[model samples]
Target chain A: MRGRGKKYWLEEIIFIGPAVLFFSLIVLIPFFIGMTYSFTTWNGVNDEITFVGFSNFLSIFKDEGFIDSFCFTAKFTVVSVTLSNIIGLSLAILLTRRLKISKPLRTVFFIPNVISGLLLGFIWQFIFTKGFGAIGSLTQIPFFKLSWLGTESTAFWALIIVTLWQTSGYLMVIYISGIINVPTELKEAAQIDGANHRQYFRHIMIPMIMPSVTVCLFLAISWAFKMFDLNYSLTKGGPYNSTKSIALDIYIEAFQINRYGTGAAKAFIFFVVVALITFIQVRITKRKEVEA
Target chain B: MIRILKNHRRIALEIVALLLALICLSPFYFVIVNSFKSYKEILIDPASLPVKWILDNYINTWKELRFPAVFANSLIITICSNLGIIIISSMAAYRLLRVKTKLNKAIFGIFVMAMVIPFQSIMIPLVRVMSSLNLNTSNIGLIICYFGFGVSFPVFLYHGFMKSIPISIEEAAIVDGCTSLGVFFKMVMPLLKPMTATVIILNTLWIWNDFLLPSLMLHSRELYTIPLAMNGFFAKYTKQWDLALAGLVLSIAPMIILFLSLQKNIINGIVSGSVKG
Candidate 1:
């Protein structure tokens, strides 16, 4: 029994050891150290570390830039999450119908998602600046004439628009799976019951797919909250930082401005906020999910 | 007449969907069309067909972006990282499922919890940690970081899938003189092909497109991946839309082709992966 136990232990270590080792070294250790750093005044490159308790956190609350970024991210999250889910759910409904071009259309919508966020931002940057300009002049459309990424409000909308374009298809896929999972028998029964399209959909399909809504909302919220690459290449959080996400703000703090301590504090705060929001969102949505 | 009306509505819906698809594709159309036009022509009318299809932009951007080198670097890193993730995570997941001890369960729980901790949260100290461990500036270092970061989701996926796999088969193999490693590689890994495909498609898309982590870890120009390279190129040639669009095309073409060819598997993989999640 002793020898057998030793062999079992050896096998377990041989198999599971690398994952635990890497996960600890990469995620666990750094995470704890980051928590420690949040309370100190250690510039990223320095040995002079002063333990200032909560000053980093205190200063972040007063920093107008940080507050603006927090509000911007919050507003961005709300608008983008709502729009993307609506668009995605609509697209999923449209494509899942008995249409001839549904497969190809699904491909078309999802193609943008395959492109990297950074590259997508760059592509849209050209579109907004040059492509939209040329289209605006040729068509003489005032709507297209506005400097899409040049002004504060329009830049905010531009970020939202690009995010929707990039992510709606992904959410569409999730919703498609959700919709398909709704039993055909239920639909047929509703049809026999003289139910109209909207009634059938509202009463049957919506409840059945609450699980998918949960998934899509979770994904969209996280993506919108943690937005960085798009912010970087699209507008560089620009037209005067009106569109900067908290992720970008933290990045700029640590790497760009070399404020590691305060950045760590902001990051910790960002993590907790994200965790709390997602946790609450998931809990609410999961409650509404029907097993059928 | 009623049937005709229903058919008419269905046709209208199909047309609407098609139009939307075209609108979705319009950006790609503009990029591809304008990429072939000169600067002045593109400025004149991005919507119009190019009068002359010029290869100059492609050639220039290719040379400037060092497309071949950066493309190779991205490929190597993606492939290596995916391979490491598959091996390490699958093995760990297998053991975690089979062993089922309090410590193993706790470790698995910690892995799952780490999923919610966004990269920005730990990135500051991660930089310091990497520097101390001499992992801050190489392709290998970046690959290791990916191994760490990528393990959680794949392990979670594998853990869920492995529950359905009957241990009787492995037990049978053990009785036939197969060692634990032998049973895993020979018996268990083969059964994991579907999950493996899902894992590969998901992770490849992520690690290939991932910019921030690679940017943070790889500071040297020569080590830059495609996204980083394109970002630098865009910043440099900010107004050179002609060459810039071409660079964008080149950067996205490989993944686009991969996606197009394997779109069925890719789509199915995404559906299964998310459904499981």
Candidate 2:
């Protein structure tokens, strides 16, 4: 009995040791150290750290860049989540129909997801500046000629547009799986009751696919909140910094400007905000999900 | 007559969906077409096909960007990171699932909870941590950083899949006097192949496309990955659209080709990954 227990102990250490070790070394320790740094005004280098309790946190209220960036991230999250979900669900509905082109269309839609958001931002930058310029000239359409990335509102919409283009397909893939798993019996029963197309869709289809809705909405909300790469490369958080995401704001604070203490505090706040938001979203959607 | 009308409606919807796909692909069209055109020609009519196809842009960018070196760097980082994450997380997940003790449960909870800790949050002190450990410059350092950040999701994925696997076979294998590690590698590991594909595909997409972690860890020119290289290229040559677009093509070509080859598995992996939870 003792020997068998000893063998089990050895196996446990060998199996689980590396994961817990790396997890603590990389994530756990840095997190605690970051919490410590958030108190002191440590300037990332030159370790002469002065402790100023909550002063960095206090300053965040007056730091207009961080405040604006938070608000911008919040607003961007709301709009992109709503828009992407709508477009993605629509595409899923369209493609799941008995269409000849569903397969190719799915491929086309998902192509945007394969490339890095950084590269896509660059690709779209060219299309907006050069391609839009030429198309505007050829067609003489004022819509294409407007300086897309020059102003505040258009730049906001530009971020929103690229985001929709990038994520809607990924979401569509999830929604399609959701739609496919809806039992056919439910559809037949709805048809037998003579439910109109819209009525059937509203009452039966939506309820049957509530699980997909849960996952899709959860995915969309979290993605919209964590958006950094696309926002970074697309606008560079420019046109008066109106498009700066919270992630970008944290990066700029720590790395670019050398305010390690303030960056750490800001990151802690960002973490809390993200956790709270995703928590609420998942709770809400989880309630709506109906088991198949 | 009613059936014919329904068929017509389906065909019309297909056409509308195809048109939308084309609209979705317009940026790709503009980027690919403009890439092959001369600077003057691009400005003349970006919508038009190149009057004189230009090979110089691709050739110049290939040499100037040091395409092979950056490509190798990205491939190494992604491959190494995925391998580490898979092995470490799978082993932990396997044990954590088999042993139903309170301590193991708490550790599993910690791993799962860390999913919400975005990379940007801990990245400040993570840099400090890596620098202190003297891991800031090498590909190995960046790969380790990925292991830390990337392990949580795969562990969660594997834990979920491990629940579906029966324990009877392993117990029987044990009765045959197969050693513990022998049963794990010989029996359990082979059964893990389907979920293994999911872990590999999803993690490959993520670690390959990640820009920020590598951007933080890698400082030297020789260590730059594709995203980092592209970022530097754009900063230096923002005005040189011809070479810039060609460079973009070079950067994204590998992932696109990989997608084309394994799209069935790619799409299948995503579906199972999402639905598994």
Candidate 3:
């Protein structure tokens, strides 16, 4: 037993020590330190700082653009998450069907996901600004001539469209796995019991894929909340700061405006809001899973 | 017969899928075709292929973006970071699996928890820590940062998958007079090839394409990764659409080639990782 104890301790040092050290130094310690900085005024360049308590948070609460960014992020999250899941699941269903060319089809659809979001955004920017401009001229459509990332309403929708286009293929991959894993016999029995396609979909498919739905929804929400590359590349928060999501706002505060403490505050608030929403979602979904 | 209608339905679905493909492919069309056009021509007729078939943009962009150095920097960073992550995370996971004590459980908890906390909350503090350590701007420092940030999730993946591996394999090696290290390197490590592939692919793709971390860590122009270099091009030449598009395409070419080549493995890794989690 003494020898076994020695062996275990030695193994622990060899295996787990580096990881714990790295994670502590890089992630855990920094996280708490950044949280502390949110309560202080640190411009990231100068060393002088004083703890001002909740004033940063209070100021953020009062800032109109901060509020607008928050609302835009929330709306973006909802719209993108819903559409991404719906489109993804539909594609997943189609791809998982017993078709000969499903393999190549899935590959083609998922190609965009492998590319960087920044590039994807840039590509879509070109498409909207140039290709759509040509189409607008040829067709003489008034709406197409208007700037995509310049207007508030159109900018918000443009962000959503770009996000959905890039991400749905990814979520579709996830849902395809989910759909394929559903008990085939259960689905077969439902089909055999004189149920039509719609009935089978409503009764068997949705419930069976609920776990995947939960996962995809959670991922989409997190992604949309933290979305930056696309927003940065396509709009850079726009002609009048219309497309600024919370992440972009935090980025501008830190990198552009050099307001590290304010960015930290915004990040902290963003964390709290996301954590609350995700926690609530998990509880609800877990309960549903248990009951089902 | 119902067979004819089924054929019609299939054809209709194929058409719809084709339209979707056109939509997906048009962006690439814009980037590639526009890269060859003169700026005035691009502005005048952005949808068409280049009228002049100009190679000047590629030549000019290659020069202006400092292609050779930045590409080397990106490759070096991605490779070093991936290597560090694979080494440290694998060792850590191996130990966690072997040592099933209370400490290990707590460590596991920490790793799983790290998966959910958004990077934004921690990024500023991470930068602060790097600065305090005097590690900012050095490639080594950036490598350390990448390893530090990347180790948690890969370790989590390795730990979970390693649990399913039977203990008897390691025990057999030990009974054959192998030391723990020997047994790990000779027997246990090779068996983890699949998970290793998954880790390598996922981490490589991320580290290769990462923008924010490199942007923050590397103020020195010499250390600029692809994304950072690409963005630099954007900032430097805002109105030079031809050169910018050319650089953008060049920046993403490595990843694009990688995706096309190992697409099967990548898709497998993503699906397995996501579903298992």
Candidate 4:
């Protein structure tokens, strides 16, 4: 018994030690250290660290830029989440109907997702600036002529359109798997009951694919909230910081502005909000999944 | 007559799909076309085809960005980080499940919860941690950071996958005088190929395109990844549309080719990875 126990211990250290060590050093320790830094006045370079009370948190609330960016992020999360899921699910339904072109079309939508968001930002910048310019001239369409990244409103919609273009394909794949797995008998039975396509969709299809809804919504919400690279490379939260996301805002405060303490505090708050929102989202979706 | 009606509907569906696909592909078209145009031509006739095709843009951008060096950096970082994540997560998952101890369960739960912590939250202090460890500057250091951030999801995936494998196989191997490590490698690793593929695809897609972590970690010009190098170029030459378009094309060429080749596996992997999670 003693020999077996010793062998088990040795194997445990050998198998699991590296994961724990690296995880702690990289994630766990930094997380706890960040929490402590939130209470101190550390400028990220100095060896001297002075502990302050909740002043950093207090100041973050007063920082209008932080508040503005938070609101912007929340708005982005709602719009992107709702629209992406709707469009994605719709595409899934359409493509799953045995359309001959569905396979290649799926590739078209997903192509944006494989490329880096950073690069996509640059590519779309040209589209908005030059491509739109060219199209506007040839067609004389007022819509294409609008300054996409110049104003707050158009810029907001431009980001939304780009995001939808990038992610709907990804969401479509998940929804496709869900729609494909809905047993054929269920659809046949619904039809036999004299249900029309819309009725069958509303009652049977939506409920059946509720799992996909949950997954897609969770992913969309998180991605929208944490959006940085696209926002950075495209607009850079431009037109007087009208489109700054919380992640970008924190990055600017901490790294660019060199306010490690305040940045850490803001990061902590960002963590709380993300945790709360995702937790609530999962809870609500899990309930729907059970009923379905 | 009914068959004709159904055929009409299918044809209509095909047309609508083709149109949408065209709109989806328009950006790539503009990018590819303009990449071959001269700077003066790009400015004068931004919408029209180039009067003369030129290779100067690609050649110039290639030298300016040091494409080969940056491409190698991205490749090394992605491959090494993926290997690290897989080994760490798979071994840890195996141990945690096999032992079934309270400590192991708690450890697994902790890792899962860490997935929810936004990178923004820990990133500031992570710099401090890395600097203190004397590992903030090198490719090896960046790969180490990837292990911490990237393993949580893969570990979760592996945990779910490893649950289905009958433990009796491992016990039988042990009884037959096989070492534990040997059992894991020879018996268990082969069974994990599907999940391994999923892990590799997702991590490679992520780490290769990620601009933030590399931006923070690698400040030296020689250490720049493709995205980082392109960002530097744009920051310097925002108006050089001719060269910029070429750089964009060169940077994304590998991903486009990768997608064209392995898109089926990638789509399947994404579906399984997300659904199971």
Candidate 5:
């Protein structure tokens, strides 16, 4: 019995050891270390570290750049989340209907999602700068002629546009699944009760798809809040750092400016905010989800 | 008469949806057509077809970006990371499911909580940790980092999946004198194909297109992945749209092909993955 117990332990170790080792070394340890680093005045280069307590956190409140980025990220998240979900839900509805070109259209919409954000940003950069210019000249449309990336407001909208273009298709897939799961009998019953298209959408379809709405909202919030790559390649937070996201700001702070302590502090706060928001959002949405 | 009217409305909606799809695809049109146009021709009329198709841009950007090398680097990292994630997470998940010990439960809880902590939170110290462990700037280091960060989600997926699998099969294998490892490799892993496919599809898309972690880890030109290389290329040739567009096209081509070929699986994978989460 003793020998058998030992053998079982050995088998367990063989199966579970590598994952624990990697996960601890990579994620678990660093997370704690980063929390420690957040309290120190470590410049990321020198060995000497000074423990500064919460002053690093305190200074972020006074830092205009940080505040600007916070506001920008908050606003960006709102606009992008609202627009992407709306567009995604609309596309989901359209594609779920029995249309001849549904599959092909779905493919086209989803193609953008497959491309890397870095590449999509670059592709749109050309469209904004060059292609827009040509179209503006030929058709003489004022909307296409604006300096899309060169201005602050337009640059902000440009980021939102690219994000919507890339992510709506992904959200559409989720919404489609949700819509499909809605019972046909319920829809027929609603139809017999003379619910108009709008009434059915509001009273029945929306409630039925609440689970997907929760998922999509959670995803959109996280994606928008933690946005980095697209912002990096698209605008680089250009036009006077007006479009900078919190993630990009943290990267620039630590790497570009070598303010590791400050960056770590900012990162800690950012993590807390993201966790709290997503947690609350999930809890709220999960309550609304129906069994069907 | 009312049924005819309803049919007409449906057709109208279909046409409208088709138009919207065309609008969605317009950017690709701009990218592909302009990729083949000369700098002067592109500037002249980007909306029109290329007056003279040019191979120069593709050839030049391919050389400049070292397309083959970076492409291979991205492929290697993604494949190794996915393989590591699948093997490590599945084994760990299987054990966690079967063991039901205090330590196992605590470890699983840690992983679940770890999912909520954003990458940014650890990234600063991660850089420090990586350098201390001599992991920074090497592809192996990057792959290892991916293994760590990628484990939580897959483990979660695999854990949920393994619960549904009966323990009788493994018990039968044990009764037949098979070792635990053999039972896992031969008996269990085969049963995990569907979840494994979902895990692979999700992780492949993420790691392949991931730029931030790789960007921070790999500093050398030789270590650049496709996205990193494209960023560097664009930085250098911001004005050289002719070459930049071609690079964009080349960089996106592999993923487009993969997605198209595995469209159904990929879609199903994403849907299931998201819904489960």
Candidate 6:
């Protein structure tokens, strides 16, 4: 072979030794530890632990707020992913056209993303509370001016609008890159075949940018699932605890209520759900990419 | 006639794009313009550009928010965390790519596995580890934690892009009596500039904007990062909208300026990073 196999083994050990140890200590070890803790009733602070197997997972089904949060997170993910792709892809197409102002427009659109999620939530909180009031008074629209984030129904939509506002620009940049990479020859060929704009987009453009769509959906779903700061800043899961996401629920369980076992169980459940969805998504999308 | 119709469609798209852009930017405009107005004026006329410009809110909020102190804290945390991340990630990436053996492959697999394991999965034990090590509630401890967490993705980014890089250069350098470390630093590091830029931009924005980790690990007031510091103003009773908005504007301004300067790279970085990662 290339050299003595033992030498190669030694070299490999020398090289990968640190990364393995680091990841184990930092990531893998902690993950398993968290899984173990899920089976125990370890009140986050005290070291006293009682072994309770599967009861934590069992309790999740009975927890009404957990169910609501799961449903809310799912609904949020679907709507956010769909809207983000549509708006983002549309903006990407428009901005990549032969327009002079597209450059500045792209920058303006992306400004909110540079700021922290907490900051965006706070900023939108201001607009929803104060700025929405102003728009309502000026335009005299009833729902437009109402306390958008006060009630459950309105608070959810308010969160949706703000999330879209903050994130669509980032996704747009991604779509822009994907669109730009589509072969010009293929596009021109479609044009020559007498395909109209809608037909070309439906057939050629959509399939070609399927990779970007996968990536966008993956990000949008995970972000929606992990969404906490916005809910925290805007409503603090308030006005009868309407906007509580899983991440927020975990935080509340851990910090607010100090229920470590329940929080750990909740967190484990969160991980499993997100992991399953993401695994399926990546597999399906990767398969599509390979097929295409 | 066909050309005219195409032109009309293009114009319509442009108008729609412009309206969407306005919707995207209006809130930002509101935040900036209202930061200069008095609280009473803002409450009375939130939409209007300040009728009489007043700098007092900015001045007062600047001091009350402890802008300079918190700015220093954020700078220290970001700089240290970023440096730690770059070092650990680059070394790990170099080692993973260069050393091709069963053990290395297994280690690399472990690193990839780290990518999907959400932070929520590990936070409970992580906190326990931190407190046990007396690493909680301090800036240094937080930076180390960030390094361990942040390195996985950057390493992945570097590893993927590194595959496309030819090994002959490194071989030649080794033949020239360069050590592995020297070869990586002298040859591979320079070649990795684009990916480095991507990593830097992504991680900088992440570190600067991160709230939850800092809020959890850091309990001390003086060590509070910008996000946590702004959150200090938000109480269960009596939320300060004016001060909060003003603080938000202040915290976002530096990064906005930075982002504006590096707009093209930011776009490229995000695209390549996510696409590859």
Candidate 4 residue lDDT tens string, A23-45: 99999999999999999999999
How big a share of the true inter-chain contacts is recovered in candidate 5? Answer: 0.86
lDDT per residue for candidate 5 within B98-212, as digits (tens), equals 9888888988998888888888888999989999988896899999999999998888998998898999989998999998889999999999999999999999999999999
Question: Which pairs of residues clash in candidate 1, taking residues 3 or more apart in a chain or in different chains?
Answer: none
Top lDDT model: 1
lDDT (Cα atoms) of all candidates against the true structure: 0.92, 0.89, 0.83, 0.92, 0.92, 0.83
Candidate 6 has a TM-score of 0.95
List candidate 2 segments past 4 Å from native. A1-4
The residue-level lDDT of candidate 3 at A238 comes to 81
**Total backbone clashes of candidate 3, pairs 3 or more residues apart or in separate chains:** 0
Q: DockQ of candidates 1 onward, in order?
A: 0.84, 0.82, 0.64, 0.84, 0.84, 0.64
- Write model 3 residue lDDT over B1-277, tens digit each, in one string: 7999998888777777767767767778888899998889999998777888888999998988898999899889888888889888988888877776677778888887777777788888888899889999598888998888899888888888888889997898789899888888888789888998888888887788777788888998878887888887888887678888898889878887888888889988987666556
TM-scores, chain A, per candidate = 0.97, 0.96, 0.93, 0.97, 0.96, 0.93
Clashing residue pairs found in predicted model 2: none
TM-scores computed on chain B for all candidates: 0.98, 0.98, 0.97, 0.98, 0.98, 0.95
Per-residue C-alpha lDDT of model 6 across residues A14-51, encoded as one tens digit per residue: 54555555566667777888888889888887779999
Q: Which TM-score does chain B of candidate 1 obtain?
A: 0.98
Q: Estimate, for each residue in B7-46, the C-alpha lDDT of model 4 and write its tens digit.
A: 9998998898788788889999899899999988888778
Per model, the share of native interface contacts recovered reads 0.83, 0.78, 0.57, 0.80, 0.86, 0.59
lDDT of 1 by residue, A52-156 (tens): 999999999999999999999999999999999999999999999989999888888999889999999999988898778877888899978999998999999
Docking class of 3: medium
Query: Tens digit of lDDT per residue, candidate 5, span A1-292?
Result: 2444877778778888889889999998988998888898888999989999999999999999999999999999999999999999999999899888898788788889998888888999998998788889988999999999999999999999899999999999999999999999999999999999999999899999999999999999999999998998889999899999999999999989999999999999998999899889999998997775
- Give me the overall lDDT of model 2: 0.89
lDDT of 6 at B212: 88
Error in Å for residue B139 of model 1: 0.4
Model 4, position A20: C-alpha lDDT score = 90
